[model samples]
Target: MSLNSVLPTRPIQRLSEALANQIAAGEVVERPVSVVKELLENALDSGATEILIAVEEGGEKSIQVTDNGKGIAADQMLLAVSRHATSKITCYQELSAVASLGFRGEALASISSVSRFELISRQDVSANAWRIKSDSGERWSALEPVAGKLGTRVKVDDLFFNTPARKKFLRAPRTEFNHIDELVRRAMLSRMEVAIQLVHNHKTVRQVEAAVTREAQIKRLGRLLGDDFVTQSMHVEFEAQDVKLEGWLALPTFNRSQNDMQYIFVNGRIVRDRLLFHALKQAYADVLYNGRHPAYVLFLSLPFEKVDVNVHPAKYEVRFADSRFVYDFIRRSVRDVVARPITQADAMRESPASVFERPDQHRQGKSVSTSFLAPHKPSPRESQAFFAFQQPVELPLSDVPSINEPLLQAYADGSDTRLASTSNAIPPLGFAKMQLHGVYILAENEQGLVLVDMHAAHERIVYERMKTQWQNQRLIAQPLLVPISLTLDLADMRAWETHQAWLEKLGFELEALGPQQLKVSAVPTLLAKADIAQLIKDVLADWRQHQDSERIESQINARLSTMACHGAVRAHRQLSLAEMNQLLRDMEQTPASSQCNHGRPTWVGLSMKQLDSLFMRGQ
Candidate 1:
């Protein structure tokens, strides 16, 4: 045969059976949370009114899910455990609009292959229930007849036992538990009408009863979120075309250290889409710090065809037809909801304490002295009166005192010193002339006109000062007359343990109450009327999110800065001419005054040339 006579042969396509199954398993079951998610979806798809999940050691050793839904048939038991087999979809067109939680039907097969699985199901009309066990699939067996309810129950043990590598990749029990908890939270939010209960290590971690109405669902969420959140959150609802977005948004002032609190769902499927996340960031742009995330439970409903939910293996991500429209809709909805005034009556009604309360207040009484400066103390009357009101106080910018004339004059003079001193030291080319427009100042440099963003600038200044104290390890601590005990999650306790010395160095006198709790006898003096519990929660949450030590510190610093900035005086309030000059002078002296902490310019300058150009004098 001639060398060129033979035609090119197509490459053979073959992957090892074990490897192929493992790959499939990886796609359907990424982690314990993935397995939980699939199981929950199956229950929901079957029209389950009540579902119970029991896990041992974060679902590492075992996981059992029981649901009061239509059970599987004896003949369908084998098919249920077969790959690519699903009852949720019948025809090819059904794939276009997938309303059910799961359609691939690979979850059961994937899960069973890696773990010892047992499934028992009984239909309402069937006299005999069916049971199947899959151990390596090669060896399958059926359970003897037994009394069973008209539903399905699945038990998975030794997850990833056949795949040691996968099991090795599993995080610590506590970390895994957090993931599982997050999954449950998302599912509960999506299907509020279904009663869901989660048990770990024989302890009930979460229990949500079926909600008859949307308002009841909101109430249940409030109970789960905590009293402070429920009291501070505002209701949000908006609809555009096929999309409807609804949820509760926490006030800008009521923010979390991390983005854990932001829960978003797409067409009843819990997902983590960056578009929605970015929209949230835009909605609370000026209100929150860069690293801090707002607390929200936004639910998005739209036609199935309008969204593609097959983006992620866990189905926690989606692609929208018009992402910008969705983003704008969410941003506007949140902004409008937050802008409206919240009433005390509404807050009280949503308060978690009103729904559930333990007979005994878990308050502790112990005192410890520290060498650091003491925490700021408020009057007993002030402390009592603060919590008495449920509504947040909305103060006008005018309420703040104007800058004194003498101070302004001094600042103006100081500005000259700054310009003269740094003229040679720092390049003038980088400095842009800024023009004050009402309360806003705009500056243009080589990069861009820096918008001084008055509030942000003031906040950065205060934050820098506070951070200096913290960095120098010279924080003042105030001892409490009575110690306060805090019950926290295991992860939080571990975080505290890891940073115990650092926290003490920062003027916090803490003691471990037990494995999952701590007692605080003192706090940093810089914080006025601080809620120790909330502060600890924020710190732990931040620590968990940013595992990098350096990044965590940076996030903490940013948070501190945001707090200082919000508390600082804003512009446009009637400031004395002198005060304005002083603020200007201060701006000239401060390093990086061109922009605020949020990367927005702190001031904008309108040069004489630009002003003349506007008047047709450029020629």
Candidate 2:
């Protein structure tokens, strides 16, 4: 009975077919939801346009899936349930470019081994349908003639019945069903062209129609992500080289408390990739509010060889050949589109003005007004052009005229109607009305009202300008009057040697005194106040771990952000109307100005309809 006596010295032996299959089942069939996922993927791989799923007693009693896809022939019925038998690939080389959703071929065999499985199919070439059932002897029943459509239907009864141990681990019925519901939702989002129906306990639970057009697609997205998400979202399409990304991204104002609403797919297969997630996080880093996650349903398409989806047995993760390239592409593309100015047209797209316009105008043969303000403000051109009224012009910071002159001239020379008419051409942020409590600016655009946090907005503008200036101009190297010699370990010395030129470009005049000694004689002007010794040590450690210089750049940016924050305008400090207007205009022209350095939104919009709804205008 001693522990040492229990050690075995027996020879290795092959496992029995039944026992081996039962073990495989543990990997492919964890619960009712896992079974559903496998079967759904199989159906999709078969080119199914319509799929129906039925479950009873939370799939403890039975689970069935029927698909309108290419079915198997009578001759292939037995082999179809056999392990390692698949039509997806024939050689090892095919693994490099797997395009199908399900290719392992073990899903069917493993699932059948632990449950009472029934399969019925009829191929287009076959004149009669065929059916087969799994017997207790690890063999399939005869392929008897059966009546069925030109597709496949699989029914699994009493899951884990043969393996009572797995059955014991089953969760509560409601808990299991919730997981199945989430899987079905992911499937629906994966392919909008497919119609899906789900039934539970003899009652229809969910139904999604096939989406064929852009409008239909958005409608389907609305059903999955809610009407508010679709209404507040923007359609983005970006293509570069061999990659293409298309989807809907919610505006910065429409953020979520958690990442539950993010759904990203790679080449039509739903995946959870860290590289993609990081890129998305960085894209929204400067625009979204802190502790908030952006909601999106994005799809990225690239060459099959560029990504490897076979990294996981469940195929939920992917590895990119050039991860950094993919990351940068996604980050830059998302940042570009999300930073565009919101226009009156964008507002109308979200909530049309026709809903609020009186019906009497239509009967009277008068054009309905799209403007939110009463009597409607005319386009900026209609007003005597706010400033020269010719074309879009850029006002440089050094050349901007005094605020007093523009404010007095605009009000004295142009009437309110003229100013309102010119709102259309007065940039996206429109014109500032007045300062609010010395912290906020109230402005009027074609859409309605816009409120901006002055300090936060100015902070972002300054930070972006600093970043641009740094990128455009070489770092000024401030040479040390007395050379600072520091000692380094073997690893740090090697890193220094490998990245010396890169370090020099970052304004570090480093020289190797010996294998274990380094002399730092110069540093970047921006980082003159930083702890140069500690900064270099941190940079070297970061470079060794990730083999990239981005860590140093990020560190530099952090210090610059702090500098910009201190230099920005402070709250509770009054600003004249002219200064506020200039800040608004600058915010419009700056990239990623929606938020400040800390991921806090700098502004929010309120449309006329939203304001009207507060007072029950139509009612």
Cα lDDT of all candidates, in order?
A: 0.64, 0.75
**Best candidate, TM-score:** 2
Q: For each predicted model, how many residue pairs clash, with residues at least 3 apart or on different chains?
A: 26, 4
lDDT string for model 2 (1-619, tens) is 9877998877899999888888888888999998999999999999999999999888888899999899987888788888888999888778788888888889889989989999999899888789999843297887799888899999999898878889999998888888888789888988999999988888888889999899999999988888867776878899988989999887654566678788999998988887787778777665554566877889999988888988887788998888767887898888777666545554354332333346453333212111110111222332322222132222223233322444434733443423355544555666677778888998876667777888888787666666666664546788887878888889988888888899998888998888799998998877777777888887788567544445556667787677777767878877765667777766655666766787665776667777788689998
**TM-score of the candidate numbered 2?**
0.82
lDDT of 1 by residue, 1-619 (tens): 9866797767888976455667789888777877788898999999999999999998988889999999998888888987789998888677767788898888888888888989899989889777889774445686555568889999998889988988999999889988999889778877889999999999999999988786787688876776566655656678888889887777554555567678888777878887788777766654443455567887889888778777777777888777767877887777655433222122122222211223122111111100000111222332332121122222111112223433323444545322223222322222223436546444322222233455655544444444544665546688988888999989888888888888787778999878877898987665536666777778777556532123234445556655655655555544443444434434443333333556333433333454566578858
lDDT of 1 at 17: 46
- TM-score of every model? 0.56, 0.82
Residue 188 CA displacement from its true place in model 2, Å: 1.3
